[model samples]
Target: MKTKINLIFPMVVMALFLFIGHTSAQPAIITQWTFDDTIEPSTGEGTASLIGGVTQHSATMSNGWRITDFPEQYVGSGTAGAQFIVSTEGYQNIVLDFGHRSSGTMSRWAEIHYTTDGGANWQVLANNNGDLTPHDVVYPFSFDFSSVAAASDNPLFGVRIVSIFSPVAFNPEAPDSTFAANTAYHRARTPGTGGNPYSGDGNWRLLEVTFAGEAIMPGGAEKLTIVDFNGGNIPELNVPFYLTVQTQNINNEPTAIEIDTEVSISVTSGTGSLNGTLAQVIPAGEHTLSFSDLTYDVAENGVVLTVAATSGMVLEPAISEPFEVVYPLENIIAKWTFDDTTEPVIGEGVASLIGGVTQHSASIGSGWRITNFPEQYDGSGTAGAQFMVSTDGYQNIVLDFGHRSSGTMSRWAEIHYTTDGGANWQVLDNNNGNLTPHDVVYPFNFDFSSVSGTANNAGFGVRIVSVFSPVAFNPEVPDSTFAANTAYHRARTPGTGGNPYSGGGNWRLLEVTFLGEPLGILPGDANCDGIVNILDAVTIVNYIMTGNVHPFCFDNADVNSDGLIDVLDVVGTVNIILGRVRK
Candidate 1:
């Protein structure tokens, strides 16, 4: 009597939801597969199979179905999993529940991922899973697809459980592990035994795979409304912008806004790639959802976005007003990719080894290696690499480069600059402000825009040199071995039992670059001939009187700084030629 009452009570409440309300209801079973006899779903039309280069076969398990022959330890994370495909045409707030049991030798981490467009694309349910404890005979796992708008009603919806790397717990005493390709979080121990490696022969059994969701019942007509990008402002290329999508009735009232629906965005007309998460679900009781980090890579005059329903909830697709995407104002002045030789690949610059450092012909991080330094900490402020370039017509200069250091090298590097050629050099930031380069290639950036005489200078040079410890040493600190004549920061910790610091350790550079915004157009240079004279005045007059076009820049004809090309602008250009006004 007790079991009958518990099951009957929920069914009665679900029946009341059918006629009383359409927006809110309890989730009902959409599909289920016990896999008791075959690999087909028992409750709905779908198929299940093993994927990702793993051998599979059916066998008698303690309960339902089982498969053996998983990937070897630490080799194939994300390359093996079980896949299930089904249609969710009338469902919202979809949820998945499953039971898994793994052998002690199997990987302890698994991920739940899904695809909306068949198998063409897949997205992970971000940061949802953890270490799969092996001691449990049947571990139940539940994932809420309610927030993933793309997982909701589609013919090609599919879900999979893939193995991922064994996670490591965080500890402040030890440095974090270097990131590998498919890392996970939260480490787990083997069943009964403490720590064991994952093996290829381990067995994994699965059962009671079920999917449930709130069924959409039709009543009021709904429409999807897509807000324009950045409220119709011109967006910069590759810069992220926010967008909003809402579901409402034909009258578009706040009370009539539809809830719990999934909509997808598509590029109606554009040449570039539309990036970031393109689909999101409206919350349970909310009508609008925002995707805050959307971006387009190429500049286009007409980029139109359309939001449409993958589920049958919305009647028509909502179209956005066409908007322009413009290029970022900053442009690269010079770039060097030292693939085979240390030479500038773009623009003009002279790059060379400096302060007794020599170039090695072997690939380190970059193809060209700058090596053979002075004795360890001997060239504290005088040795390393130097680059001389002219920012003749550019302002707001920024320098960027990819750099790496060998284990034995000093990690501290100081940036020095000379504004009036190489006659006088000063560290860009004092000795205490040195940068620490890693063994793995990493980027370093310097902004010289605010420095005096950096812009429009024909004599600009910068250097990166090793530096000694600038701070007084204390024996209580972890780095007490560092002396005044030694590098303040060690690339590798001293007591870690790695290679010792030596002068032979080197630094490698790649993709060295200088970026700046071009200076404003020369005043009164209507022809853009790099000079302002009588010809510029004549050119301004010609444009105003006969509607003639300037050979170079029409904007230069507006010499009076007014937003028009008229006789007043021509008079302003004449005054500059006569030296009555500053050029």
Candidate 2:
């Protein structure tokens, strides 16, 4: 189980173990310095030896010895090796940040050496040949255990700086004097040449040297602020920072635990608290602390506070752990309908009369009577009456008309559509002669493909109309008597395909079908029959010439099953067409 504690709350949860007494690891501090001037001798007496330096000078430290600008000629002088004792034994890495400030004509070089049995005999670990120029900020030279022999057992080492070729005498005591004379005249002089002195005179400055080692800290209450709300003026805070604590076991093996958390601040009015949360797994190792936040403010100018663990939590070897939360996208389909309650009679010629006619005696005799025809009726008009439909773009308009009575009327019902919000209309279906009386079970389909462009927009509508001949109607005729009472049900299509009666008239709206397989040919269906076969070849050719085939033409034409529709497929199609082979 994972528990999430918001960092914003003032009360921070302390690690359970921190309350009890437990020893942890100590943090490491890496520092570097460059020596360009002469230094005073050591006041305390000890075995002091000059490892390497200019003018044979020497500097002493509590742990080890360092020499600046030392000549290479005195490698094994009297008691020099014995005095320079190696102190860096358990360090894993070292960084040498050194450079020279010179205006000479000679190349400069540096080398690092290691000694196991005192300093009697030395072995070169690394060397640079004229690679670094004077006055250049050479990057910190990082040296790993790979450069040392049996590094785990012998981590102690020494460094040496040498001037390869130089005309000016080098001075470790006074670096500025050698280059000062040539300040105006020899500005373009190369290293180790006249105009700028080298060796004991000037032309050299050592920047910094640093050592990095591992340390561990354990047993403490880790109070981490992921975010802080300074005040109402600056309310929201979102910054992520990492705190790594080191821990060691009885065997002296180092283990680090990294806590990656964010601090956030939400301030209201003048009072605000900082809150934070953990969102990543803590890894084992010597963890380092880093922060990346755009809105962080410190009260003091140069007093950056370094936070440390102080409670129950102790850095130690343990399993990794993590923190996060997970959520999904939401959507819905809404629908609305316009019933007779709102639209009674749509227009002057339209009516919703039911069970009136089975046949046509007159154009307006029965069957949803249309008083007017074509806006103006001529001598027993043959045109039909119109009824309009409005939609809210979401619905696919489908005109459903049930065939209650069967007879050959002078005209058939058709549907018209308008994309311009009823500004103009296009006949979706004109005189649907293909529909037969027996086809009553299946609604007449007019795919909205013809009006998809117009209907895809905001406002769209449909108009249902029936064409009949008023002059052709016979009052005594049985067909005429029943024609006025043609009753049918209107509705929308119930599948994925477009409006089936898009071009047809005399359709009514019904419940929508939200889910269904869209009507079209499946992939590799060449014959346009939803399958691949020899007929597919003929279909391909027909499509190529007439631009009429199923949507997935490429799937059907690529006979070799490759993802391409090229000449090879054409040849394969030709072969299939000639009955040379089967698909």
Candidate 1, position 30, lDDT:
79
lDDT by residue (332-402, candidate 2, tens digit) is: 11111233232322221122322122212222112232222221121221233333332322223343332
User: Candidate 2: where are CA atoms >4 Å away?
Assistant: 1-53, 56-86, 93-107, 134-140, 147-149, 153-156, 162-203, 215-583
Weakest lDDT window of 10 consecutive positions for candidate 2? 323-332
Report, for every candidate in turn, its global Cα lDDT versus the true structure.
0.66, 0.33
In angstroms, the error of model 1 at 211 is 7.4
lDDT against true structure, model 2: 0.33
Give the alpha carbon lDDT tens digit for every residue of 173-199 in model 1.
112244443553223333345544446
